[model samples]
Target: MDRRFNKHEKLKSKKLINKLFTEGQTVSAYPLRLVYLPTSLNEANTPVKTGVSVSKRYFKKAVQRIRIKRLMREAYRLNKSTYFNNLTTPHAFMILYIGNKKPTYLQMEQAMNKLFNKFINATHKATSDEKNT
Candidate 1:
């Protein structure tokens, strides 16, 4: 599976982002919350497109917020293929840093693994339920 997080995989559309907050469901792992919406994306080459967000209210500095976002992106980049390689559905994800304190890269990476695991289980269960119904 491809491990690189290229520009095509970065979520940037404003209207889609707004719809995501309104219609998306979330899977949370403490400091990291993954808000995801399954949708047909404009770019057919990418199965998932994601954006990272760190709250200014919590970080209080652009530098701090930027660092957190970087950590989040790195964590996602490493963990993406492990859980999503078989994903037939495309998704848009907003990964929000919901913690008040600064996090180490190690912490972020571990949380990201847990987050993706939880996401896979949740999506699988949802599909199974739909089939059962």
Candidate 2:
């Protein structure tokens, strides 16, 4: 894979976004919360599609919100391979930055790692339960 965060990898469809938020499962690690739905929304070649959001209610300024989102996306892009390699199905994810104050990249990266681990575990468990039944 290219390991690049490109336009095709971005989750932008309004309909898909609505379904992702409404029907998805949530996982949180401190400042970050991920809402994900396991479905094949992306093309056959792309295994996952992701969206990032930082609340204006918390950041107030557009610059602050954009900065936080940048950090979040960078963290996720670097660490997403681990998630994709282990997945049994494609997932649409919305990563929400919920912190009230600004956070450093290291802090956000750690939180992103934790969130991904939690998500992987949850998906693994769900698949195993399905196999047993």
Candidate 3:
């Protein structure tokens, strides 16, 4: 409800990060790819924790990588409610910027919107299947 990206809402645990990359489901919208896994940790309070990454292979410069990551984070922060509001379980998410070139904020936002929609649908389907099983 605060709609603010806070410290506690950030994915920081090394173990969880490793698990997320290794075991999470992925959804891609061109320049943006989302890796997410349903989590039980801190389920009663925080429903989601997110991290953003930009590949060094694409952006050799740290500044460029940081800028891209910042853009992705801003987009996700602004639009996360669309994905989070419908979530019945907690999740850890990694938003990876996979473009060869830097994207405009508008472009990143659009991609993020698509990625979030895909993620929401996938999550809902998974939850429903679980319920039916």
Candidate 4:
């Protein structure tokens, strides 16, 4: 199983993030803002790069921030394989935690999974509708 989501593949550039926020489709599942754009990487067989951000104000202590980020990352790593398998095109994904307080790993993981499932279903429906039309 491919388990690495490299930095270069990640939507890390600030400019891209800004553009996506401004123009990309958005779905809010509380704590998670899923911003996605339909695009592809040049590399052959590359999984879409994803980034996760937690608000600093919500997590004042570095330890809390790190813990949340780690939980988010692990959840994404485990659940993202299903997303990759189902997606027909390459896309950029951003998982933004927009909560006002730190959450436990289990809480964050559940939220992330819910957000991801919604995104995948919506995207797939959109793609299928477009193809049918």
Model 3 lDDT tens row, 1-133:
4678998899999999999999999999898889999888764778899999988897899999988888888898899876687667789999998889889999999999999989888877887898999
Q: lDDT ranking from best to worst? A: 1, 2, 3, 4
Which runs in model 4 stand beyond 4 Å of their true positions? none
At residue 80, candidate 1 shows an lDDT of 88
Model 4 superposed RMSD (Cα) = 2.0
The global Cα lDDT (0 to 1) of model 3 is 0.88
Cα error, residue 27 of model 3, in Å, equals 0.9
Which candidate ranks first by lDDT, i.e. highest?
1
Question: For model 2, what is the error of residue 118's alpha carbon versus the real structure, in angstroms, after optimal superposition?
Answer: 0.2
Count of backbone clashes, every candidate in sequence: 0, 0, 0, 0
Top model by TM-score, which number?
1
Per residue, candidate 2 scores C-alpha lDDT tens digits across 9-75 of 8999999999998899999998899999988764877788999999878888899998998999999
State TM-scores per candidate: 0.97, 0.95, 0.93, 0.85
TM-score of 2: 0.95
> Once all C-alphas are superposed, what RMSD does model 2 give against the true structure?
1.1
Model 2 ranges with Cα > 4 A deviation: none
Provide the lDDT at 24 for model 4.
84
Return the TM-score for candidate 3, rounded to 2 decimals: 0.93
Model 1 CA deviation exceeding 4 Å by range: none
Candidate 3, superposed: residue stretches over 4 Å from native: none
Model 4, span 12-118: residue lDDT tens: 76776787777789878888788888765665576576788877776888887777778888878877776677566777778788888777878887898889878
Error of 1 at 81 (Å): 1.3
